[model samples]
Target chain A: EAGVAQSPRYKIIEKRQSVAFWCNPISGHATLYWYQQILGQGPKLLIQFQNNGVVDDSQLPKDRFSAERLKGVDSTLKIQPAKLEDSAVYLCASSRSGLGDSPLHFGNGTRLTVT
Target chain B: GESVGLHLPTLSVQEGDNSIINCAYSNSASDYFIWYKQESGKGPQFIIDIRSNMDKRQGQRVTVLLNKTVKHLSLQIAATQPGDSAVYFCAEKSRDSNYQLIWGAGTKLIIKP
Candidate 1:
């Protein structure tokens, strides 16, 4: 019954500095996702993982952004040399199945601010 | 005149009144739709969902209506309460099995006593 868990609810860093956010998905969920939500905009998918393997990461900024789901249970998204454009909230979610009627359970999210 | 955006960033409605939130999607292939509620300082929470097959789906006091022809989707909250106040967003899923859910800019709802 526990919801998705994320760490460091708030973070502030200077531009070019490195930062990372973490997520722990719901138990037994097969699908995990990381999204970037800007103020006044909908969330944009950054990367997706299915049991420690990647499913999609087309939108991810390969130059700086990277994500990993090592054990298939927890994930970490990192942005090296962070930029002002990366100040949006980072959200991690999970679903029982990758398709069908399953709804995503999200964590509180980490709010990153780059100066 | 319909900008797929509200004239104001926030809306205040009296309790017990009906609340309607609207969204416009650009992709015609977006066949699956959902509505999510996000409280202040928290991630979004799922409210209701509807597919291209059906025009409407009801859950508790919430209703989701999809108009594929106009590329519009709306969420209706009956007898709205203070607890219902939050940012509402509508998401669309492509027909492909990529599991990608595209989203709309959020609309913030404010409830008054």
Candidate 2:
């Protein structure tokens, strides 16, 4: 029962540069979500994946952000041409089931700092 | 359209004292609510949850009270500690599995030793 795992705990890049974050969810978990947490704000849902299928990504900026969960085990969120505003913690969470008080297990998150 | 938000942006409490954080929600359609605690450099961790049908739910050292009639939620911690020092957020969602969450702005809790 390991927790959700994420890569590159910290990242620093320049604005307009491309950056990508990876997430490996808990075993047997079907729902995976990517959220952006700006300083002093709650995490905003970017995209949600239910076993390789996109459930909701309405908040994802189609022009600059994209994510994929191939085969439904791991996921990657990419932010291209990153802007200063795009610099925030990218959190990856997973749940045992899709609904209820099942609770979302989160990783330490990748803190992206765009200069 | 519901906006989930906290009454305060930050709270400071002494160790061994109880802590009560408040939240106000605008969406009447939301039937589920949850409270999350987030520490620095980490993601939110679930503390407690309550459904609209139920007014209160209790957990170890924690309790969540839901007042759907007034669209409010509160998290009560019996004995606040240094470990409890983190930002708290209240999230609301519908019964449907696909419905997304509406999260509050969050309240930063500071514990005094």
Q: What is the lDDT for B112 in model 2?
A: 93
Tens digits of lDDT, candidate 1, B21-105:
8888777766677789999889999888887789989999998888878777888899999999899987777646465776667
Q: What residue pairs are clashing in model 1?
A: none
Q: Estimate candidate 1's alpha-carbon lDDT, on a 0 to 1 scale.
A: 0.85
Which stretches of model 1 miss by more than 4 angstroms? B1-10
User: Chain A alone, model 2, TM-score?
Assistant: 0.97
TM-score against native, each model: 0.90, 0.95
Q: Candidates' DockQ values?
A: 0.64, 0.65
**Positional deviation of residue B86's Cα in model 1 after best superposition, in angstroms:** 0.9
Looking at model 2 chain B, which ten-residue stretch has the lowest summed lDDT?
B93-102
How many clashing pairs per prediction, in order?
A: 0, 0
For model 2, residues A1-115, the per-residue Cα lDDT tens digits are: 9889998899999999999999999999999999999999988999989999998998999899999999999999999989999889999999876675567778889999999
